[model samples]
Target: MHNEPLAYRMRPKNIDEIAGQEEIIGKNTALYHLIKKGHVPSMLLYGEPGIGKTSLAHAIAGTSDLPFISLNATVSGKKEVEDVVAEARVTGKVLLFLDEIHRFNKLQQDTLLPHVEKGSIVLIGATTENPFHDVNPAIRSRCGEIKQLKRLEASDLLGVLHRALTDQERGLGKQSIRITEAQLLKIAEGVNGDARKALNVLESVVIASDEENGETIVEDWLVDNLIGRIGLFSDKKGSHFYNLLSALQKSIRGSDVNAAIYYLAHLLETGDLVAVNRRLLVIAYEDIGLAAPHIGAHVLAATEAAVRLGMPEARIPLANAVIEMCLASKSNSAYKAFDAAVRAINSGNTGDIPPHLRDTHYAGAAELGHVGYQYPHNTPIGSFGGWIDQQYLPDKVEGTEFYRPVQAGDEVKLAAIYERMKEMKKNKR
Candidate 1:
């Protein structure tokens, strides 16, 4: 219809008509062949908004020659699903395209399980949220494949714009419009890989433009006026935020100061100073550990200052901490040692504490097996205060070693001390 939105009007009629997602429906791809052969299966598609999860479902239905039934999980209930099932029974087979499928509760999801399993309803569920995290495992497992659609690139959006501009049947081809390739690209890039958004913005600009001598001129300024200040794609509770955090830690761990700063700035843009500070603290201890032990205290101080300063100003201290962490000598020796010790304990290596190492503070302790406890403070061997050679570990783990200090920063000195102690203990001196 002429009144329909350009994006809806330009919806691809089939897999071949779809502009992007070549990886999923490219002619040579398995899904393409499956759809072409009328073998479409129940599937779950997920990604960011406007990347065409619904479009893919419709295209698959079109290619498979199956009746397409649409419903939104947020609004649709068991009764609606039952109606679809009832229709499927009559039709023999039907493609059910459930939008916002992650919003479905366990009971609601379970309602479709039998129908999906029996092949009566070929479910093509779509969601912006990650299915693995939000969808029930039963629904996820029943899907033929959990397809992860990517954000449409700027080039993909450009193609979508070109199609809309030329297609007289569904697009603006009937009108005489003047818009440059650069201006089209501006619309494409401004939407941040969202073709639907791109088309909407394009429509807004076109409608705003007045006819000048039989030509509707869409200008550069018009596009910018509509798509003001594009923000980075990130959600505090979503996968992308975690990805930014991961990238920040990894860059710092790899000692790439530039990359570390970039990711830090990216996270800072999200205004999550607490998350940034917390992750920085973790990086300091977990990655930079005994290598530069003071780094932990430094990071703690920086994070504290950041909390006190808050926001706009908080970024300064965080940037300082990120830089320091990126350049700091890295060693996971201490982290690894603790993990190894845990592994030993998990594997049942724990045994009773040696008699000499057990606590002796309780009354009548000497009567029990806790006697013969060697107090290290009582025996000092030349410059080694509070030191002695005695069995400390339980018999089962007596000789098991965990702390292996690496040659990094202050840990090098620790390694030497550790070696001397080990040698002294070995000689029982």
Candidate 2:
């Protein structure tokens, strides 16, 4: 066997060979067509580590038969980029794959913009960080597309493991090694959808088995020893953390208690109590909304308890909050209403405040026509007896309907109360 790492030896030779990322590289997909035509634009591939960003870039270059040049933005400087650009200018076709493109500073990224614009090189930038936040806008704008890769599914990882086992030319097929389907699945789960980690762990087991005995027969204990130290796949400050948070909220919104708790466990494993607390609060108010406004207060109290108690113990209250929010009646009316109002303001519908509703305590307020303000509490048609007819919003948006409550949980009662109040106001008018 060549001494190359299994991940390296098993790199896909073409787009068809790439595992996972079917959304991007599947037949008839935009990226698949781009590579098939051998005319890809400057692109950014973004996702968590070991999800095949580098592999896909190489596959594109290989399948297209384009000259491939690779650089790591973390180590390479402006000089390296300039050198690559110069070389690419000489060669009419070159696919420059820059790994960890987020590591490049503004000056370094800017250096490649013109070359990319001029078609000197078809840039394929790979990053684990979100390009919008980490990459220079100028460079991001020049990239024709940003492709997001997801964590590989267990089935896909299993396929990768099998390929390494049986591909005699490049893999360990020549060795007398045997791994059960169950053992392969165990390693796949342990690696958290990372193909590189899966392969490395598999390779480690094979080597250890070889050293111990000429024949390599993988066992549960051997795999356990190698994988026992591997922690949950998470980066506290990276896209993985945010993705988990999103999943948690969506699960709650979808009322999938199991999924919500699952993602909650992952966040707590990272000791990210604050993110969990904040996102739970948002879900309570945004997702749960007026359907169960009490849940918002309950979630706040739980969050407070979590903060005071801290992890291990904190997870209890957080879990309680998550379950309650998940089971609580769901509504987004409050959230949508706020967004609608914001849109109106942005669209220049913010007319002058009704004079009667304007501040009247100022010295010249009465003379400036701010005196018609109704004291609803003092009036006979006040809320004590019944709601008074009044214009609360600015004239431009006077009759705008924003808070349309759905017949969900407490919102049903709210809708009834609102209709009654509107009727009373209409009678006064």
In terms of TM-score, which candidate is strongest? 1
lDDT of 2 by residue, 1-429 (tens): 487898899999999999988888899688798779877888999988888999999998889998899999989998998888788878875789999988878778678878888887888999999999988788788898999998888899999999999999988888878788999999998888889999999999998764346568887899999987463776898977998999999999999999999999999998888988998998998898999989989999999999999979998988998898889898999889889999989999899888888887679988898877666666564334534577889988987888888889999988888787777766767
lDDT of each: 0.86, 0.87
Clash-forming residue pairs, model 2: none
| TM-score (all chains, Cα) for each model | 0.91, 0.83
**Pairs of colliding residues, candidate 1:** none
In model 2, which runs have C-alpha deviations exceeding 4 angstroms? 1-4, 14-16, 26-41, 132-142, 167-169, 210-213, 229-231, 338-402
Superposed by TM-score, candidate 2 places the C-alpha of residue 425 at a distance from the truth, in angstroms, of 1.6
The runs of at least 3 residues in candidate 1 whose Cα sits more than 4 Å from the true structure, single-residue gaps closed, are 369-386
Model 2: ten consecutive residues of lowest lDDT:
379-388
